[model samples]
Target: MKTILFLLRKEFLQIFRNRVIVAMIFVMPIIQLLILANAANYEVRNLKLQVIDQDHSSWSRQLVGHFTASPYFNLTGMVASAKKGITAIEADEADLVLHIPSGFERALRREGTASVHLNINAINGVKAGLASSYAQTIILDLHQEIMPVVELPAGLSSTFRYWYNPDMDYYTFMVPGILVLLVTLVGMFLSGLNIVKEKEIGTIEQINVSPIRKHQFIIGKLLPFWIIAQVELALGLTVGWLVFDIPIVGSLGVVFAFSSIYLLVVLGIGLLVSTFTDTQQQAMFISWFFLVIFILMSGLFTPIESMPGWAQQITRLNPVTYFVDVVRLVLLKGSSWWDIRSQWIALSIFAVVINGAAVLNYRKTD
Candidate 1:
């Protein structure tokens, strides 16, 4: 225990002595949090719209007014024909084109039905889908306002109440996940590079020839990063609350408790990487390869449920996936310790297995 404490002291001294690492540890995360929280948004807004109105009727003009008034759309131009609207789309000047054929009002009044055509740029499928849905909702609202209503038999009506995030602010959904990412990057990259840096500088040779046991050395290397990562998580959460107004709906203790174990999984992976690699460059490349795969498969940007079956199955193997889910659940949903029990157990097993492998792989005699 005394030996481990001495090694921990040495590790912290080394970390603080490096000015570049100090800046990376404290400054870079705040900058990234500020930038990425605002930039990585999924909401589509301010779509350019072109209109083709052949009827020149009041109803057609009203439809155009609805589209222009919406926050999601900008009125780029009003063309006289469908050909002109199509030309605007082809020129990248319009995202959607509304074509109201001639005699639209006449058809509605005479036959109680009318048709309007929508031409949308479908190059970005997700953006196009959102734009289409927003436009359709506006048209339907106009239809409901204009058409006469008749009393009918009572039926079921559904009302939605969005829990946790009532305003549907994208920041609320994104900040917690981003916090996980930052913590993971710090813990994984720094710890992974620690041994490799020592090896490069000829310091690891001295440690290998010391009286320190393998478990003592591994714990010494792992604990400093584990503690630093927790501090980073706290800093991120504070920034998230102060800057973005993100709420902490659960206990801070619960968050740190899970984080303590999760950092082990991350730091273990780092140590495991260092065990196989000889140089810092090799360690970085290998670490980044695993980080990218883990993060992309972690459901940070997309929903796990929406992924294909095989891809979803792969997420089960990702430690980041479980941490991301657990953090969001605890912070956003106010989930209890029992609520995250399964994840806790899984991470515990990972912590043991990964660190065990890293210890077994580290050469004490060489």
Candidate 2:
């Protein structure tokens, strides 16, 4: 009991003594939260549009007006010919080109249907897809407005309501996931480097020759990081709320409770890495390799359901995936403990298995 406390004290002292680490512990979360929450957005905006308007009619000009009025598009200029519009796209000056033929207004008035050619640069697939979708929607809206109203018998109509994120603000969706990432990074990188650093500096030799038992030494090494990670999580959540206006719809206690177990899983991974590696650099490289795999497969930036079947199955093994789901569910959807019970159990099992492996692998003497 007293021995573990003494070891914890020693670890905390060592952590605070390093100026760079202290700054990272306090500063990194705020900077990352502020920047990434704003920068890592999926919403496509400010697409450059060049229009080739051969139709010098009201409907043609009205269609051009629609593109100019939209926030999603910036109409660079009106070209006299389709050739010029194509040249703009080739020169990387425009993302999309709208070509309105000379008979466009006549076709709309006579046949009630007009075709507008859209030439979109497909260099960035996602941007192209979104820009195409947005332009199509705008054109469809104008078509509906200008066409004569037809009375039809009412059958069924569907209305969409976005539940958690009503405004569809990307920041709301990203902040919680980014918070989980920050906590995971601090726990894994710092704890993984701790023991290996001691080994490098000839301090592990002294600890191995001491009276400390294996589990006690592991606990001593793990607890400081565990506590620091929780503090980091709390700080991150606060920043998310204060800076980004992210709401915590669920119980804060539930958040902390789940975080306690999740931190153990992350810290256990670090300790396991430390047990196998002799130097901090080796531990860092190994930790980063696993971290990248875990984060990418975790559904932080992309939907796991959209992944291939084998890739989705792989995500089931990633601990970050579960935490990301749990945090978003709790903070965004106001999910209760029962809602996250399955994730909680999975993380608990991971905590036991990983920490057990780390302890078994650690030799009392070298």
Candidate 3:
């Protein structure tokens, strides 16, 4: 017990003694949250909206004016032909195009229907979705006001209320996800390379020749990094709250429980990487490469639904996806254990699979 505690203490001090590293552990995630929050917004603010007004009437002008007035869009171009509007939207000069047909006002007056063709790039699906909906709402509002002489039932008019983060601030959504990245990164890199350092220094052979069982030795070695990563998790989250005003809307105990289990798999993965690598540099590079791909594709910066079907299917096999999703659920959505049962189950399965692989690969013999 004393030896275990002493080793843990030594490891903790080694990690925290470096000022640059300590700051990076706490600061990088916050920086990423800020950058991603800015870039990850689904709202198309300052949207370059091009217009093709064929009607040349008050109603058509007013329609274009409505889009210009709305904060969600900016009128960047006014084209005489629909082809020019298409070129604008296609050439990256505009994000969306609004075309009022030649008979727009006339059709509305006589036929009760007028066509407005809105062409949008759905590559970034969320922004496209929001842009379309905002345009639709403006058009619908104008329609209701102009033609109030006729009325429809309740279904045609609906109001949406965002349950949490009503402002749709991406920072609030990204803080927790970045927290997962920070913790996972610290645990994997430190634990993966620490053993390599020991081996490089000829200390690993000294310990192996002793009576220490592989499991006990491995667990003792990992315990410090594991605890330190958890501490970093707490500190990172606290900073996120104070700096970014992110809220913890769910149980801390639940978050910790899930995090603890998830860390097992992460640590196991690190140890597994260390087992295959010859040096600390190799371990670090491999672990970092693995982490980058896993985090990027894990729905941390974007929604899983927005990914291609094959990409989404591939992400399902990545454990970080579950970790990020569960943490976000707890933080943003106040999801309880029952609400997160599927995540818990998937993480449990992941833990079993990874730990099993690590144990199989971990050997005392050369």
Candidate 4:
């Protein structure tokens, strides 16, 4: 215990002794948080809308007015024909085109129905889907206002209520996920890089020559980083709350508890990487490859349910997946500890196996 304490003291000294690393530890993440929280938005706003009105009727004009007044769309241009609207879409000038055929009002009044063609640039499927939905809602609202007695088919009209984040603010959803990522970056990269940096500076050889046990050395290295990562998490959460008005709906203690366990999994992986690699560059590239895969598969931006079945199966092996999911569930939805029992069990097993492998693989003699 005394030996571990001494080593911990040494590691902390080494970390604080480097001014550049200290700055990077705090400054870089803050910058990334501020930028990414705003930039990584999924909501489709300010969509470019074009209208081709062949019929200069009041009904057609009213429908176009509904779209223009909508906050989701920006009416860019009004063309005379469908061909011109199609040309605008091809030129990347329009995201959606509303085409009203000639005698549209006449057909609606006489036949009680008229078809309007909607052409959307499906380059990005999410954006197209959202734009289509927004446009359809406006059209429906207009139809109800203009034609009162004309009732649509049953089961077609339904209302939805957004829970937790009713405003659908992207920042609220993204901040917690980004906080998880920041903690991960600090824990995995710094811990792996620290060991490799010691190798580069010939300090590791001196430490290996000493009468320190492997467990003592590993504990010493991981403890300081573990503490640092927790501090980083706290700082990030504070910034998110104060700056972005993000609330901690669930138990903050639960959040810290989960993070503490998750840190061991990542730190152990870092140590495992350090055990095999001789140089910092090799460690960096190897860690980077895995981190990228972990982030992409972690469902940070996309829904896990939307992914292919095989791909979703692969995410079960990723520790980040569990952290990202649990953080969002607990923070946003106020999920209880019992609700995350499966994640806790999976992470615990992951920690034991990963750290145990790292310890077994570590060689003091080599």
Candidate 5:
């Protein structure tokens, strides 16, 4: 126990002694958080649309006017025909192309039947889906207003807003998740490469000959990085609150608990990677690759629902998923511990299992 404490103190001093690394550890993430928080919004807007109106009647003009007036739609093209509109959409010039059937006004007024073709690019499935739904709703609302004398079913209403985020501040939703990811990258990358660096420098042999046990030495090495990571997290949260005005409406204890558990998993991953690689470059590359894959799959930049079934299933095993969820829940949704009990359990279990494997794989003797 004494050895462990001594090692922890030693590691802490070694990390803090490097002023440049400490500055980067805090500043880089805040910079990224500030820049990306604005750009990573899920709110759909200015959706480019092409109108292929075959019926050049007053009613068709009115429909086109609906598109022009809508905040959701940006009328980018008024093409001669549906074929041209579809061509524009296929060429990626437009996100949505609406082809009103021939004699649309005649059919609606005289025959009470008309179909509007809607072409939406599903490449970005989530935004495309939302845009398509919004377009459809606007058209329906137009029809309802036009036919006001017609009676409607009793249990139907369109009185709710989606509120992708009610506050509409992108940073509120983004900072928590992205900050967690940024810490994951730092923790995993630095710690994973530390042992490999010592080995490369031939300093590991000296540690091996010392009276310190493997566990003590290992714990000591991690102690400094762990505390630094926590300080970085605190700085990130401070930035989130001070700059973006993002609310942290949940318990700080829960946030700390989950963060500590999540760090264990990240550090375990780093240690495990160190065991396999002999060089710092190899460790760095391996760590970055894993971090990229985990972040992409962890539903940080986009919704997991937007991904395919197999891809979504793959994220279930990623440790970053739980961390992102925990932070987002505590920060944005004000989720209580009970609300995140299952996530806590899962992260804790993964931390234990992964750290155990790392310790097992890590070399003790030089």
Candidate 6:
């Protein structure tokens, strides 16, 4: 116990001595959160719309007006010819082109039907799909307003109620996930770098020659980082609540409880990576490789359901995926411990296995 406490004190002293690393541990994540929370948005907005209205009728004008009024679209160019609208799309100035055919209102009133040509830039498939969906919704709303009797079928109506995120704000969805990322970045990178920094400064050999046990050294290394990561997470969540208006629907105690175990997984992986590498560069590259894969597969930006079956199966092995899932489930959905029992259990098993491997791989004499 005395030996381990000595190692812990030494590790903390060394950490506090490095001003640049100390700043990185505390400052970088907050800056990343401020920038990334606004940037990592999935919601499609400001779609550049080009319109060619041949009919020039009041009804056609009203439809065009809807597109301009909608927050989803910006009418950047209006041309008399379809050729010009197509030019705007080809030139990359517009994302969508709308063509209202001649006699659009006349055909709608007389024949109860009209055709509108929609040309979309399909370069970015996701953005194109969202733009199409937004346009369709506006068109449907316009149809119900103009020809209420024809659009409705004997009192059949549909109502949408959004749960959790009522306004469908992207920040609400991204902030919690980003907080997970911030904690993860610190846990994996800082812990991995801590041991490697010792190797670089020649203190690793000095410690290995002393009568210090391996487990004591490893525990000393992990404890400081675990505490630091939790502090960063608390600060980040406070910032999220104050700046982004994110709500903590579940118990903060539950969040910290889950996070404590989850940090074991992240710190264990970091220790494992450090054991295999001699230099900070090697540790950083290895950690970055896995962290990138974990973040991408974690469904932070995209939906896991949209992934192929085999890819989704691979995500089950990723601890980041479980943490991201449980964090959002707890914070946004107010999910109880019972609701996330399977995930918490999986993470516990993962922590035990990973740390066990790290302990075995760490050699005192090497």
How much does candidate 6 score in TM-score? 0.96
Q: Worst 10-residue stretch by lDDT in candidate 1?
A: 149-158
For residue 82, give model 5's deviation from the true position in Å.
2.3
Q: Per-residue CA lDDT of candidate 5, range 1-366, in tens? A: 998887777666766787866666877788888888877877788999898888888777888898889888899978888778878988988999988877887767665556788989889988898988888887886677656433333245566654435856778778888888888988998788778988899888888788877678778777777877887888888988899888888887789878888888898899889988999999998888988899998988868888999998888888898888888888776788899989888888888888888888876663
lDDT of 3: 0.82
lDDT of 6: 0.90
Each prediction's Cα lDDT score? 0.90, 0.91, 0.82, 0.90, 0.82, 0.90
- Give a tens-digit lDDT track for model 6, residues 1-366: 998888889878988898887888789989999999999987888999999999989989999989999999999988878888888999998999999999998888777878788899999999999999999988977788876745533246588999998898888899999999999999999999889888899988998898888888999999999999999999999999999999899878888899999999999999999999999999999999999999999999888999999999989999999988988899889998889999999999999999999999988864
Candidate 5 stretches greater than 4 Å from native: 1-10, 17-20, 56-59, 90-93, 110-113, 121-127, 149-164, 167-170, 302-314
Evaluation by TM-score, superior candidate among 1 and 4:
4
In model 3, where do residues sit more than 4 Å from their true spots? 87-92, 121-130, 149-159, 305-316
Instruction: Say which prediction, candidate 4 or candidate 5, comes out ahead on lDDT.
Output: 4
Give the number of colliding residue pairs in candidate 4.
0
Which pairs clash inside model 5? none
Better of 2 and 4 by TM-score: 4
lDDT of 2: 0.91
> What's every prediction's RMSD, in angstroms?
2.0, 2.0, 3.1, 1.5, 3.2, 1.6
Query: What TM-score fits each model?
Result: 0.95, 0.95, 0.85, 0.96, 0.85, 0.96
Could you tell me the TM-score of candidate 3?
0.85
Local accuracy of candidate 1 as per-residue lDDT tens digits, 275-299: 9999999999999999999999999
- Model 4 lDDT per residue over 1-366, tens place: 999989989888978999888987888898899999988888888899999999989989999999999889999999888889999999999999999888998887776678788999999999999988898898888777767544433336678999988998888899999989989999999999999888899988898999999999999989999999999999999999999888688988889899989999999989999989989999999999999999999999888899999999999999999999988888889988899989989999999999999999988886
Write model 2 residue lDDT over 1-366, tens digit each, in one string. 999999999999989999899888889778988999988898988899999989889888988898889999999988888899989999989999999999988877776667999999999998999999999888976766676543322235455889999998898899999999999999999999999999899888888998889989999999999999999999999888998899889998889999999999999999999999999999999999999999999999999999999999999889999988999999989999999999999999999999999999999765
